[model samples]
Target: MAQESKPVAQVDVRNIGGIDEASVTLPEGVSILTGRNATNRTSFLQALMAGLGSRQSSLKGDAEKGEVTLVLDDETYTRTLQRRGDSVSFDGDPYLDDPELADLFAFLLENNEARQAVARGDDLREIIMRPIDIDSIEAEIRECKREREELESEIEKLDSLERDLSDLETDRREKVESLEAAREELESVNDELDELDTGIEESQTRKQELENAFQRVRDARSKLDNIEFDLETERSTLSELKAEREELHETIENAEKPDENADRLAGRIDELRGRKRSLDDDINELGSVINFNEDLIDGSGIEIYEGTPSDDPTDALNADGQTVCWTCGSEVGTDQIEATLDRLRELRSDKLDERSEIRAKIQELTDQQSSIREAEREIERAQERLTAVETEIESTESRIADLEDQIESKQEEIEELEQDAESIDVEGYDESIKLHREANEIELRIERFKDEIEEIDDEIDKREAAIERREELKSEREELASRLTELRTRVDRIEETAVEEFNEHMETVLEILEYENLDRIWIERRETEVREGRRKVTRTRFELHIVRSSSDGTAYEDTVDHLSESEREVTGLVFALAGYLVHDVYETVPFVLLDSLEAIDSDRIARVVDYFRTHADYLVTALLPEDANALPEEYAYTESID
Candidate 1:
């Protein structure tokens, strides 16, 4: 079968770290990136590493949005990093390669174990052995140990449950005994309640009879109360009748004779009435005279005679010259008419005074007559009232007698009912009530005992279920323990195989690099006890040791710590390369990236580069211009960055 070329053919970077946009086409064999410090050469290599599946990249600052595209022999792969997220995609097959291996073998950047091992004061064993999957083996062992611990925990739980099962059985026995006792006590109570059932029933029947008698008493009492109320009403009616009769009798006595003062006033009024009639006639005559005189004085009622009157007092001498009186048809002098008119006026004034007095006397007589009439009417009414009172008094007395008889009869009935009620035997009723209450209490006790027994049964079921679960867990624990042992054995076998391969490859690489004073290099599996706080931990690890031949031609084994800086650096590098080769990392990734190898001299760097070229299908290195220039011209395809 023909060997396949490396997957990465070209890398195009945009907005990654210090590089805004750059594209570098990778050639076959070794390639070197030549740039001064801070020239973004490391960024370019990191992009390749990222495209090959490394997470070390800046997604902020100058490289806020970055993308690295890798041109493969038959396809293209691209990785993008944005502020939100990152993604890797491919046009053909997905980049199924492990990104962790890329960090392990693909990059020799600062702080990488391969580069730091030279200057670090820590043991070189861990540094040399880092590239292999020993940590993965240790992790597997830890997982097995964790599984074993879990099995042990389950076994402990099972043991505890088994121990608890004994106690649960003991408790169950006690509960059974308690349940039995309670059931026996409840049965005895139920028997006692059953024996009292007949007595309770008989007492209940008797209680009903007594209740009926008591109800009869209550009814009789209610009837008696109604009778008493009726008697009281009748008595009140009789008293009212007597009171009305007495008042009527007094009124009749007082009205027996009319008012004497009225009679006397009537006699006086009769005399004054006769005088008043005479005076009224006089007043009328006086009024007529006064009117006549007034008319005569004015000469309104007198006919005028056909004569003229003289101014003199005695001027009337003949009928033609005299004035004639209209009533008498006689001639009269003015002096004579004046004298008659004056006399008539005086008479009328006197008659008016007498008439006023008569009218006063008549009015007094009329008032007396009215008083006499009112007294007669009162006397008649009193006599009628006295008759009515007499009739009501007889009727009320009859009703009162009837009410008294009815009340006495109701009282006798109520007394007989009360005596009968008192004769009913209440003792049997009370005894029945107490027996029923006791029966109810016994029933409750029986129910409580039943419930307790049920609870005990439930507890027993729960304990039995727990014991069954413990058995299942015991079986599971056994299976887990078997798996844990198998895993541990497998881990041991894999460790032996990996350690042997790593030592063989390191020996070969050390020889090829021409490391002086090194006879052989190998890795040894070591176990040490360490105390971390309160815990004593057994730590298993692989340590790197080298056999150095002294000037006396004798070989002795020593650790990597006694080696020089360049030797250590070379040893770490070769160890990493050996792990890569031994584990077939190159078969999948087929690439290694190296940068900042200033700790090793130029000549040694060329040898390391040459070793990498033979081992990896594709190798990329970042170095300063001078370092790039020192590499063999044909082996390095140099790329420069300004």
Candidate 2:
């Protein structure tokens, strides 16, 4: 079971000068009394630590009494120590009803002193000398750090090697790729050169073939021109012969037209005969009508009076036998009439005679008609020769077409031959081939570099193995260094413990006249060294452990380096308690007047109360409203407000 609920204490506050009357009650575990500043609160606490039951209680050990006290553990008693002017009643029995003793608390106070003299345990005494041991630890730390530095240097060298190899490998790979690309380019250019050679040959041969064909065609055209001239002369002579033949044929056909001329002559004779009969009829009729009124004349030159045919000449003759014309009114003379009649008969006779002569000429020509057979045969021969020459021209055109086909075939073959001859480069090609060879050399160099890189990689692997070995060596060195440092620190602490023990024994003798916990103290050698790959350890390496005690013979054996805040302050109170306990032994004054009694805090005060409460000697303590409330259950009734 844990500790049960303990009793609590209450307190009241008021202005010592100008502060408020603040108040509170406190429960037992380690109650804290907190507030703002300028409360004059600590003054109230200072008055409480002044627990001098007798006049000798105020004496210092070196002065009169050795220890001091407060109300605790029910009562107080005279301590063992006697000062120059104080009195004592027992053998270091300062606390009368002392039962509440805490060793951890007394150690806290002693080790933190200017020198740890009051402690009776060696370990308890060693804390005061902790600072001096650090020098030994520093030496070992330096050695370990040196080893770490050496390892770091080795790592840097390996890193440099790794980088150099990596860069070389990269450069080698790039050179290899360059060589491969050059090889490909060379092959492509060679193919293009071959095609260009073929093209050059084909064009040259075709141009030559075209020149020869053009010459052959020119010669053939000259021969065809002469043949065309001969043909044209023959065609002209044929045209002349044809024209004469056609004219002779037309003359023969025309001479066969005698009936045409006879028709013309008969038509004219009929017309003349009809004219004479008309004249005779007119003269006879007129003779019948003119009885003796006119004399009739029957001569070739004489004509009867007949006016223009448009007029009635009969009406013109008067009743006397003759009359004048009605239109011109000419005289109607018998001779004039006879002359017109005679002229008409003579014109008719002439027309008949001319027609008779035309018929006779047509008859003579018809008897002389014949065909021009010689001219016809000559024209036929000329036309046949023209046809023969035209046939030869057609045959020559066919032969020219065959020659053109033969030339085209020969030209294609010669072009291919010319292109093949040109494809083999005689000048620049050697340079291109040399460049390709150099590219291959570069590729070989790259391969060699790659092989070297592989060897370097193997070398790097071996170096890494060495680096691992170095790291292992460093690790061992570091472990040894750390141990050496710890041992040296121990050795220093042992020496310091011896010194602290001597001082603490003196302090205990002064305060209690006894140091019973001294047997727990001893010093040990601490430092060790590495020899022949082994640690030569020391058997005794550090200080001994010790404990402290109160006047009631209670022990305090601990280290105060780790004490809490309240515990630390209470440790100070214990120191004060030792002074009070030795009150009667070194008597001079009755009171232990103090200031700032709250410095120890109420929890520790309560602890002190339980140890000195019965205090066959009386104790008086003060109560500030705040601090008084902080008194714990173990010392609840120990407080007495002043």
Candidate 3:
């Protein structure tokens, strides 16, 4: 039986970087690019990077345009680079739409940021965390907090409404009981009045007169009862309005006043916005300069008027080295340009951080301004409500006084009528008079009871209606709580994961390499206070620590600078691999490119390759012929590109 052929990725390049034309097929697992120096090994890697949607690759000097085509798993992606004056523009759909993750992690070229960060002792935390949008997360957290606060307030209102239910039910029951008793008393009084009757002779005239007087008394008493009910209602209303007025007064007193310099904050925000715009322009210009210089260093489009470039152009760059400044057309050192570029990069990073801080500051100020405006509106509304309540209280008090006066007048009128009826001086008239007076009292009591019962029913209906909203408010509050939890932990979770991944991979790689004196290497996540704007905020930092063993077997901490070139290279590669895994880059881009590993010996290099091979579908690395010999016989090898 014949063995099945392994899967392969074929790459075609034309005039990209130093490559005039090249075709290479990479197999699954490790594929080695074996050659001596200046054999276009790095150039082919650049071409591959171009086909993977990286803009870092440059067109060849003599070629006006360059193209790279990649075929993997029967899927073909192409990238075209066109020379546009001092800059090169790339067009075409490539393997990855966004190459930021690939550039930072999967492409481990010598100049890759993640690899260089460890070598240069750059902020490991910043590089590992570059992909996360912390500001957006924090903003979302703030929004969740606000929503939760609103939900809490609504839930409180629902709870208060629910608590009042029992009291309202009790009041309604009491009013109903009083009504039943009054109706019974009224029936008794009516029966008693029916039993008393005057004789026939004096009954006709005197009975009619007495009946008129008694009817007038009854009418006065009924009016008085209604007037007294109005008085009670008005008094209750006045009491409620006075209580509301006091509350409004307290609200106005407790309301926050806006900042005295609130208007100045708007102006400051505008100023920061202008500053950020200026920084943007500077960063763009600096980036263009850096790209152009880097191309020149790569010997692309620089042979027209200059002396012959060095075979290894970057090897000649030193602090004292001199070269012609392309922009100013003056004699300047190559190292000076590189140093300037480095400074420019640092400046750009600082400005970018400053811009982020300014953005967050602007959001903070805007929120504060909105809150201040809301407070002002609240105070204004409270004042208006207080005024309305005071006016209502005065009107209700005046109405209550008028009702009291009417009650007194009606009472006097009833007394006069009673007196008139009592003086009739006829047989059986007094008994009839007393019965009529008693009947009037009972009737008034019954009317009052009816009015009370009606009010209680209305109140109970309102309380029950309000309590119906309780469940909905509770549900909303629960959702807000869940959202807040997710938002608050998002940043912390990412930070912890990154730290753990780095420490774990670093320990494993150090053991695999078996560095004689190296004890351990790890990263610790720590927090420190940083002053942003006028406030101090806590921020997380990643601290890289190196442990080394002395001859006596005593372990001590070491700095990155003390690590050998081979050790540094291994550490950097491990760090990049950690990032690759942390970002899940393998799921999208299956290829990992490695170069510039001449510092590590062949045996350890093989071991390192073996370690990284397990994590990628295809691991493509460039090596010298001697170093490539150390790899296993089964690994695919491309000695020359055609």
TM-score of each: 0.40, 0.20, 0.72
- Report how far residue 215 has shifted in candidate 1, in Å: 81
| lDDT (tens digit, per residue) of candidate 3 on 1-642 | 113344789999999866788999898888999976556777788899889988767677678999999998789999999988876778998999988788889989776778878887877877777777665776687677878888788778767766887886787788778878877877887777666652334647777787888888888888887887788888888888988988999999988777645567668777877887776556544544555465455433233235565656444343556655655656677677778878877876676567667766776776666566667777889999988888898888889888888989898988888788787776766667777777778777777777776877776787677668777877887887888887787777777887888889888888888999999989889999977667787888888899999999999999999999999998899889888988888887888999888889999999999999988888999898999999999999988763
Model 2 stretches with alpha carbons more than 4 Å out: 1-145, 156-459, 466-474, 480-484, 487-642
lDDT of 2 by residue, 130-214 (tens): 2233434555555556665675676567666656766656665675576566556656755654554444434555444533443
The true-structure Cα RMSD of candidate 3 reads 6.6
lDDT of 2: 0.38
List candidate 1 segments past 4 Å from native.
35-38, 59-63, 83-98, 114-486, 518-521, 531-537, 546-562, 625-636
Who wins the lDDT comparison?
A: 3
Q: List the residue pairs that clash in candidate 3.
A: 322-333
lDDT of 1 by residue, 1-642 (tens): 116565447888786544678888887788888755545676677677778876554432333477878877767888876754333222222243555555555566643544444334344444333345543554565566667677678667656766776676776677567657756765765576456544544566766776566567656655665566677877888888888888888777766475456667778877887887676455444443443334333332222234554433223234344445645668776567667766765565565445544654454455546667667877888888888888888888888788788878887886787577567666554444344444444444445445555766676676667667766766776776676676656545545665776677667667766866788877678888855334566755666667999898799998667887767766666656645554567666767888657667776677778777776777888776677778887765545442
Which has the better TM-score: candidate 1, or candidate 2?
A: 1
Q: What's the TM for model 1?
A: 0.40
Where is model 1 poorest over a 10-residue stretch in terms of lDDT? Answer: 85-94
Model 2 residue 593 CA deviation in Å: 49
Query: Could you tell me the lDDT of residue 529 within candidate 1?
Result: 83
lDDT of 1 at 503: 75
